[model samples]
Target: MNKQKLLIILAFFSIYFVWGSTYLFNKIAVSELPPLFLAAIRFSMAGILILVIAKLLKKSIKITRQQFLNSTIAGFLFLVYGNGVFVWALKYVDTGFAALLASTQPLFVLFLLRLIDGKKMQKKSIIGVGLGLLGMYLLVSQKTIATSEGMVLGIFMMLSCVLSWSYGSVFVSKADLPKNFLVSTGYQMFISSVLLIFCSLAFKEDISTIKTISYKVQMAVVFLILFGSIVAFTAFNYLLKVVSPEKVSTSAYVNPVVALFLGWYFLDEKLTNQSIIATFVLLTGVYFITSRKRIAKQKVRPSQKT
Candidate 1:
């Protein structure tokens, strides 16, 4: 196939494999690192690395006030809230369940997009949303979700996190961002890291505790920074340029599968029949939504008299 097709494939693999594994990493990392502090460090380090690279490349690091504001908002929602609560929730839930809940982001995005843009709902997307919701219910039903008051609070926090992420995604699409996507991403990560770090300090996380953490957990943190932040984020931006946004977004559907497998393999997490069925339903829905446009285009033929 063409180079564009190859890049799309590479992007899919990057997000599917790297992000899928990130759930496991987050679960492990939180065991040693405080949630907000871990996020702060990861994004801060990645941002600085990317910022240095941008300077070396002579790319304009200057951004407008609007761009900075947008980035901060996006960072707060997607990073501080989205990923922050995710890391926190991982403390209370298993890797599998966390992945399942996080994967519901697309459904929220679909509805939010319609509301923000006053766009009509596509039939396929509607079906996809339904299926996704069903999958979420099945996935959660299989697990004996924690009933403690703290766990209940954590669940609500995670749900709020997902909504914030979805909202931020829509905002990003509309925002006047920097021409260099990588540079823009670096700025966002940097801003998010700073914010999270202040929050971490406010909570009084013990930095000394980090030194006592296991080697495996430290390695997981490094992997999350390198693979999830740098490699996967760069790959995703490249894929957006090479392929349709819709196609690139399919990673959302594939990531949960990878997360589930990794959880099972590494954490020895149970995969119930309910989860299996939910996976089938979710995949089927995603396939239909992603293919719907092409399928409709194919239906129009020269031979048909209109």
Candidate 2:
């Protein structure tokens, strides 16, 4: 195969396996570290690493003023509220279940397109929205989950994170960003890291805890920074440019399955029958929504899962 073809295959593996594994990594990391602090560190370190790599490659890190503001907004939505808050929710929710909930992003994107862009939802998309809602209700309304302490709040906050990510997806499409995709990603991570630091302090998270963090949590964070944030994300952007978005969006289907399996196998998180059924229903809806020809035609980057 040509080098380009080989890279595409490797990129697909990175996104499919690496992005999926991030949920498990985040779940492991959050067991000891404060969620906001953990995310701030991950993003800050990953952002710096990315910028350094970009500079070594002679890519420009400069952006227009409007681009800077847009990057900050995107950073807040995608990284701070979207990812940071989602990690906080993971403290209560199971890693697998959280991945299932996040699978609804395409559904959220479909709704946002209709509401904000005044675009009409096609028949497939409408049916997708219906199934998506049903799947969500079934997933969260389980008796066991509802009875757990703080789970209700966790579920609510996780949904809010999905909304934040959905809105960020829409915002990014219209926003003026750095010409280089890697640079834009770096800025988003860097800017969001700053915001997350403030969030950690505002919540009075003990910063000193990092001094005693376990080897496991430290390794998880390192994996998240290198594989999740940098490698998988670069793969995602690369795939977006080379492959059809429809093909790239297939990660949505694979990621949750990978997360669910890893959580079950490694973390021993239970997988109930309802969750299994909900996964099927929810992913089917996501398929219906994203399979629309017009949506597939647009270069809509589905935000990172973890």
For all predicted structures, in order, the TM-scores are 0.88, 0.97
Where is model 1 more than 4 Å wrong at Cα? 1-9, 146-152, 289-306
Q: What tens-digit string does per-residue lDDT give for candidate 1 at 60-121?
A: 89999999998899788878878876787778766766666666666676677578767576
Predictions: Cα RMSD each: 6.8, 1.1
Local distance difference test, candidate 1: 0.74
What TM-score would you give candidate 1 relative to the actual structure?
A: 0.88
Compose the digit string of candidate 2's lDDT tens values, residues 222-246.
Answer: 9999999999999998998898888
Between which residue pairs do clashes occur in model 1? none
By lDDT, the best candidate is 2
Which candidate leads in TM-score?
2
